[model samples]
Each structure stands twice: as structure tokens, then as C-alpha cells.
Target: MNTISAKYKKDFNMDKSIEEKLVIRNKRFQSRLMLGTGKYRNIKEAVESIEKSEASIITVAVRKIEYLKKIGKSNLIDFLDWNKLWLLPNTAGCQTAEEAVRLATLGIEMNKKLGQLENNFVKLEVISDSKYLLPDPIGTLKAAEYLVKRNFTVLPYIYPDPILAKQLEEIGCHTIMPLGSPIGSGQGLQNFYNIKVIIENTKVPIIVDAGIGQASEANAAMEIGASGILLNTAIAKSGQPKLMAEAMKLSVISGRKCYTSGIMTKQIQGQASSPYYGIPKLQ
Candidate 1:
């Protein structure tokens, strides 16, 4: 077992050497795993988990922060260190294009307060469906167009639809975040085929967002050529958020390395690792 483990470790190290940084909208990110600042039991746990994840880009729901401040409760921004982390403000709870645009505008102000003067990154989400939490395509497209016109680096979250992804890219979205499954369901890549198509067709980054419940799921998405991942519940709702975050970080790195190293093609029949012709005539 030790020998087998050592062999994998050596191979992974070689693969890691050729791994490239995840670039989105001209900004380079060393870690392809982007974490959300929600669902944790406490702020301390959330901060610790973010540290363990080693994710440079952190997504925060602008409405939640605003509500917390309005209620006189501590908000996520107060705890995060702006110097080390880049904020990806999201319009999570907005159900309409107008509402999403409004929240995105507020997010820009929030970023300005965080000392991100020129930062305009916004994760645009427009969902009217409460039960499934599925993004509304028409609303999302409308909001994305408005945001893009205002020069915001929009990263819209949507279902794994190849056509919509191309439209978003054409409209100047920095990245396309396709749901792996329903939000927080942990179903893990239910739309794997469509996502692959999106990755193949689009020129922008394809980030697998939501429904990734474990490290293996995260790895699977990255291995299939996803540019990055944005997950919250899998880490925040885990038994040990910190440990799970670390697992996710390593899994993203391993998956990216595998993709960059060029994974072996699938074969229908089993083949011997060693050449079969080297043996002498034997009884």
C-alpha cells in the first residue's frame, strides 16, 4: 500500500509541475477553487475554512450583507482581509432582472468600500423559482446585458445550457458558472454532458457552481476541463468545514493538474501495462 501510494504521489508531483494558473477576465488566480462566505455556523469558522481553502476569490451575497448590517448584526465583510482576498459580489436572492441589476450596483459600492476601487466583479444570479433555485435564463440575460454595459465584469450563474453560455460570452461576461445540479442538493454533475459542451463551445471560463458535495465531485468537474469552481454548502455544511475546505483545495489542484497533464483516453478492453512479447517459449 505504501509503495502504491508513493507511485501516485510521484506522478501527481510531476503533473503539478505543469499546472497553469486559472485566468478569468485578465485576472490570474493561483487556486481554481472559489468559496462563498455563507452557511457556516459562525464567522470564525467561515474565516478559518476560507483560509484552509486557500481561495483567492471569495463570493459574497450583497443582499445578505446589507440585511445583516440593517439588523445590526456582524457581516462577512468586517471579518475578511481585503488585502489577501478578492471579492466576487453576487446577486444571489434577486428574482428579477431589475432587482439583480440593483443588487449588482450595490455590490459595486460595497467593493469600493472594501478598497477595491477598480474592482467590478459581480456574480449575477436571477432566479424566480424558489423551490429549485434555478436561474431564470431571460432574466439572467437581461441583467447580464445591463451589467456588461456598465463595465462590470459579470460572471452569471445559470443552468448548463450551451446556447445561453455562448450568448453570455458574446455579451461580454467574464465567466460562465453552470450549475452541476440543483443548488445545495449535492447531486454532483448531473449536467456533465452539457457542461462539457459549454466548455468546448465558449471562449470564456466555465466555472462549475453548486451541487458539488465532496472533493471527488470537485475533482471530477476540474478534470473534465472546468476553469474553476464556486461552492459554498459542501464546505460550510460539512462536519469539519476547515478540513473539507483543505480537501477541496487539494482536489481542485489535483484535478487541474490532471487536466493539464492530459488524461489518458478511455479504452473498451483491458490492456497489459507491460509488453506481452518479451517472454521466451514456455510450457
Candidate 2:
């Protein structure tokens, strides 16, 4: 049973700006910074870090829970806060269409606690490989098209391939996320130029997700006009996760500011600010 409790149909008809940019579930956020809610040592730390960062949204993975005979059962319920920032449940482990669909249905039911079904906010993460962790684009495309028909806010994580991005858009992804590097490698922007092209040509928000190593890299992505960034290990695995979260928050804001304000042009030949005409000896 596809028990989607997304209240969007009853409450939201999907609003658009005059420029037709899709409003984020009727929220006024032009900033493209997306945060992950995994890898924190504890739920409290995760919540506190995310809150302190002041991120507009946080992504969480919907996976399995093991039941211990001694301890009974405990899911990732510790991470749930119905009152916090918008919940973005990702199908992180699904590699096939069947798995994705089953999990997506479970997510809808599980998300009722977090109010996801009501809001229609879910990010689809379909990875086929356990080793390389490559997304099954075929599965992703199928899932994306299916989810869109079902009225879910779909964001797909993909490699820096522009045509795949276009295919995703064609199937109804509201935004496409191109990886900055491998997930959790902190390798920085490995496919920088391709990401730029994706950002340039995509109609939807072009989110640079994964493999961001530092605040400077986040800034670079924004400078290139990426809609926003989604990061995890870069902040979560930091020596001081809380402090790192704060740094990332400011970096995003600073990047947005720099991007909006045109950068100073690069020059190969030195063009003196004090002209030869202005210098007394030269004059």
C-alpha cells in the first residue's frame, strides 16, 4: 500500500514566483544550502548542530532497524523531531526500482510521524553499487517519474553528468543534485566544470551535493551560481562538529553574498589602479 500522507494536495497547490522559480513548499528560501542529518554521535547533537547552523532543511536516510532480543527494538527514532526543520527522508540504500518503491511507501508511512506525507518533501537516493556507490540512473529515473506522479517533492542525487540531469528534469525532479566529489571523501570539487554546466543549463535548482571538504569549497560552488549545497561528512566528521556547522552556515551566507555581488574580474596583464597619467613622475 502506497500510504502517502503528503498533505500538499489538500493544503498546497504549488505556488510559483513571478519568475516561475518553484517555491520550496511555499517557503521563502532562495538560499540553496541543504544539510544532512546523519553521522552525528547523537540525536541531540545533530539537532543542536543543525539548529545552530540555521539550515532551512535537513535530510535523513530511511533505512532498516535491527531488533535485539535483549534490548527489544529501537529505530532511528532518536533523530525524529516533528517540530524542527523540514524533514527530507532519503531512500539511500535502494538500488532497484522495486526496492525504491517499497522503501518510498514505507517512508510515507514512517514520515507521518515527522509530517513528511503532509508536506510532500522527500529526496530520492537510489544507489546501485555498495562498493563504488554509483546511483542506478535507470532506477532513479523510474523512481523519480513515479514519485512525481504521486506528488512528492523529488530531489535526485547524481553524478556530474548533464544529460542525466536533463533526463531527470524531463521526468519531473524539482531539483537535481550533482556530487562535488564522492560521498564522505571530502575530496573537494572533482568534477567542477561539469557541475558548472549542469548549474547553467538546468531549469530547476542545481544543488551541488556530496564531497564538499571545506567552507571555501562551498563558497566556490555558490560563486559558480549553484542553487545550494548539501553536505555531510565535511561538517559531521569534523573534530568539532558544532563549530564546523557554524562555519558552514556562515560560508553559505557569505557565498550567496559574493555571488550576488559580481566578483572582480581576473586580469592577466597588470592594470594599475593608479594610472601612468595619475603618477606625477609619469605625467
Candidate 3:
């Protein structure tokens, strides 16, 4: 063996192969998958699917709670294992900066009301275009700025724009959530280059949110340096939600492993695994 190869062979350790846990602020998550609570057939299915996913974080839209309370029905929070999971309250229906800010404040209040004392994180979303459901960058930034000052860990969901991403990071957003495609479209990485650029340029965690259609898409997101993925419609709308949830769990892990292992580079031409010089001739 060559001197360099022989030297490194003696120092290689098998114990250092374990994947590192994902950390955002003070919390560390074993599963980087973040599932959303919406559009499920029922609460039972949602609970089963989420349990199968083994996700460490779950997003709950605060706007739906008031209606549920008014109708004398249980909300998503009533079924969640509050102590085990981190609940990320989102302003899903907010269309303006003022509305988003109000919802965020009310979300924290509801968090305390539900006995989730440590819940100060919010997914800031201000979507002006209801037809496409695209994020309003101006409103999102405005809401994020307001929330950060009030000591809320703001994770703004936005369109994949590098400049906006940088601006959000500069404004002290806890994490940057750039969408893979239009909300609930299940299109999968429509703006991959922009998303990659955002991942490379931003200092904060980049959790790809919305429009993930399949397990492979989730895997690809993690492979390309996303800190995590937030998904809902893909699993919730599937015929077998529980099984799809399990697939998502495995896919995220697979993608994370591939990323951690340092994937091999691509080549234009074929490379032989065995040496032709040592091979015997065929008759």
C-alpha cells in the first residue's frame, strides 16, 4: 500500500459513523421531518399517520382552533402528545402583515392555554394570492420583523428567492422555510436551483416547506442540504396515509445518510470497477 493510504487505514474508526441529530436553537431533533396538521380525513387518521412518521416537530394552524371551539369539537392539539413533540403554530390563513402578527400573538396565547408553556415558535405565513397560495414576501418580512422583537422564534414560509432569504436571515429569523412548489400542488422542487442557492447562502436552517409529492422528493430535499422538510397534503391525501407516513420517515433518513456520507461525484464516461490489465483473455 502507498504511504498515505497505509497511514489513514490505521486511524479509521467505525464508531464515528452515526448520523448527527438536527438542532435548531436549543432543541435537538432525532427526526428532521416536520409534518403539518391539515386536510386529513379525520383526527384519528392524522394521529395515526403522524405517529407512524416519527417526526419530532408538528405544525398546527391556529386559525382553525376558534371554529372548532365554537362548534364544540376537539381541535388537533387535544390529540397531540404535547410533551414529546414541538408544536409549531402557523398563521396559515393570514393575508396581511397585521393579520399575521395578530395570529402569531394569539397562537402563543393559545399555546399557553393548551398547557404548552415552552411554545414560542411560529411559522409566519402571509399569502396575499389566495388562488396560487403564494407567499407575500413583503408581508412575511413585516410579520417576521414584528415577531422577532417580541421574542418569538419566527420561521417564515416563503418563495425560493435567494435575496429574500438573505434579508430574512439578516432580520434574525430562526429558520428559513422556502417552498418546493406552490402550496398543496405536490409538484416537487419546481425551483430547485433557487432553493439550493438559498440553502448555500443562508446561515439559518432551511426547511423546505410545501409541494412535496412523494417520498423521493423528501429524500432529495435532505440530500441537497435542507435542514428539514415540512409536508402534509402528500401524506394526508394519500389512500394509505399511515404507510405513506412510514415511507416519508424512511426517505428522510435515507436522504440524510446520503448527505452525511458525502456522495460521489458524477462523471460523463464509464469507469471500470476491475482492472483490465490483470484480467485473463476470453476465447
RMSD in Å for all candidates: 4.8, 10.4, 3.6
1-283: candidate 3 lDDT, tens digit per residue: 4355765764564324346777777777888999999999999999999999999989988888877888999877799887788888899999999999998998898778767787798999999998999999999999899899888989999999999999999988979999999999999999899999998998888999999999999999989888889999999999999999999999998888888778899999999887899678999
Cα-based lDDT for every prediction: 0.92, 0.75, 0.90
Maximum-lDDT candidate: 1
lDDT order, best first, reads 1, 3, 2
lDDT of 1 by residue, 1-283 (tens): 4455764878756644456777887888788999998889999999999999999999999999999999999987798899889999999999999999999999999999999998899999999999999999999999999999989999999999999999999999989999999999989999999999999999899999999999999999999899999999999999999999999999988898888788898999997999878789787
Candidate 1 has an lDDT of 0.92
Model 2 over residues 192-260: C-alpha lDDT tens digits? 999999988888888889999899999899888877789988877888888888888788777766776
**What TM-score does candidate 2 reach?**
0.83
Show where candidate 1 strays beyond 4 Å: 1-17
Q: What are the runs in model 3 whose C-alpha is more than 4 Å off?
A: 1-18, 280-283
Higher-ranked by lDDT: 1 or 2? 1
Q: Candidate 2 lDDT (Cα, whole model)?
A: 0.75
